[model samples]
Target: MRILVLSDLHANVTALDAVLEAAQGRWEQSVCLGDVVGYGPDPNEVTARLRKLGTQTIRGNHDKAVAGVMPTDDFNPVAKAAVDWTRAQLTPEHLSWLAALPPGPLATDGIVLVHGAFQDEDEYVFTPAQALDGLLDSTAEVTFFGHTHHQGGFSYQDSRLEVLQIHPRPTESFAALRIEAPRRYLLNPGSIGQPRDGDPRAAFAIADLDHQTVEFWRVSYDISSVQERMRQARLPEPLVQRLMLGR
Candidate 1:
């Protein structure tokens, strides 16, 4: 089955809608790596959409914070502020659902899903060395992770690990990666709500592991509208501004 992989959907409904529209009819099922809320407006709206879509989702750090599963002691002031605001905005039912989201390294349909590192759900895997453990220790040939909000991953074969520089070009919809056997992979689909991979477009991935292929996709959305909503919500200025910059 073709699977849609989403991550870091940090409450920007516009971006999420754009991605869904672009991915329509291309996927048979969906899974999320988490961060379903936080850093943007529409926390409740985004949570509702995720529930309606019924994507198999895992808890992100922000999700944990908002759900009161974890403390915001380590978060920066700006992030803590957004977390507080997001908490205030989410309905009791949505908050309960977010709290119940399972932490990942969740295995299903022939791939593994993780919000961060395989061993630590809160860690960020941004370097080849950092990605090594997940690549070598993961149970599946392909493992998808989020949290860094970057669209790329690491591939390992014969003990040689190489970072996969995979992303759709500015004018393209997706870039395909041919998944080869006897090789372990750790991939990031990027952030759906706030991208930090130097590209403003929303990012996601479609995997057809039976065919040995994965497609990294990027879609354009109405950033101005989302930013305006954030402003109206009185969310952090940095959070509102970063949507357009995709920082």
Candidate 2:
């Protein structure tokens, strides 16, 4: 079965919609790596849509803060503001769902799902040293992570760890990675709501472990519209600006 892999949705329903529409009919099951709600306009709508899809999900740092499961003390001023705003905007039902979301390193559907590193859900795995723990310790050969918001992966086999260049180009729809048996992988699907890999397009992935290939995808969405909504909601200007910049 082809599995839809999504992460760092960050409450941008428009971007999520564009991804779903673009990926429709190509996936059999769906899983979200985390941050279902955080720094965008449609917290409730995104949560409700995921609920309706029955996607297997895990919570991110922002989700934890918004749900009151974690503190915003570590958050920067801008992130703290977004967290406060998201907490206020989330519905009781959505808040409960968000609160109850399990921390990752969750094993399901033949693959592992993690918001960040396998050892620490809140930690960012951006380098080989940071990624080595998860690559070595994960139960599954192919484990997926988010939070860095960059679409790439790390692989290990013969005492060597290699970072995989797996992102699709701006002109391409998707990039394919062939998963090998002896080698294990720690991959990121990038961010859907707010990409930070210098690509403005919404990012996601489709995994077909049975076929031993995963497709990293980038799809264009209505960013101007989403930015407008963020402005109307009085969200932080920096957040609004970064969406378009994909910083």
Candidate 3:
């Protein structure tokens, strides 16, 4: 089965649309890690789109904050502002849907989907040590997680950990990796709406389970348009600027 893995789509429909367009005919099933809403405009539109696509999704930290499942007191000032704004933008039904999303470490077909670390839903597995810890704790052979918004992952084998960085060129669309069995892995497909890897493009991944390979994709979208919408909504200035900077 070819599964499209997406995460941290913080409500930028333009980026989501671009990713969907780029991934056309490439996947049969879709699974989202989380954060369907937060940090950007068009929360309702993005959630509706994901629903229509029938994506199996989990609740992200931002999603939890917006749905009132988690407190925003821990969020940064800019992030807290976005969450507050997004909470207001969502309708009753949308909020309910967001609230209903399950927490991760959700497993299927030998792969696990998580918004963050398997042990902690809100954990950010950015460093090699964190990745190793997550891999050691999880039973699944591969764990796909999001939260750091950086498009890469790590593999643990023979008591050694190796970082896997798939940095595509500006003109390239994706970077492919062959998944070797028996060796554990923790993968991050990156962020769809907000990419913090110094790349201002939408990020996603395709896991071809049948072929045992994972492909990371990055697609450009209308950043200015999303920024303009954020401006109109009076969202935080740093949030609007980050969309262009991809930081």
TM-score for all models, in order of appearance: 0.99, 0.99, 0.98
Residue lDDT tens for model 2, 59-159: 99999999999999999999999999999999899999999999989999889999998999999999999999999998999999999999898999999
Model 1 per-residue lDDT tens digits across residues 21-44: 999999998999999999989899
Cα misplacement distance, residue 213 of candidate 3 (Å): 0.7
Instruction: Kindly give the number of clashing pairs for every candidate.
Output: 0, 0, 0
lDDT of 3 by residue, 12-51 (tens): 9999999999999998999999999999999999999999
Residue range with the least summed lDDT across 10 consecutive positions in model 2: 162-171
Candidate that beats the other on lDDT, 1 or 3, i.e. the better one: 1
| Candidate 2 Cα errors over 4 Å, as ranges | none
lDDT of 2 at 242: 98
* Candidate 3 lDDT score relative to the true structure: 0.92
Clashing pairs in 1: none
Model 3 off-target regions past 4 Å?
Answer: none
Cα lDDT for residue 215, candidate 3: 95
Regarding TM-score, does 2 or 3 come out ahead? 2
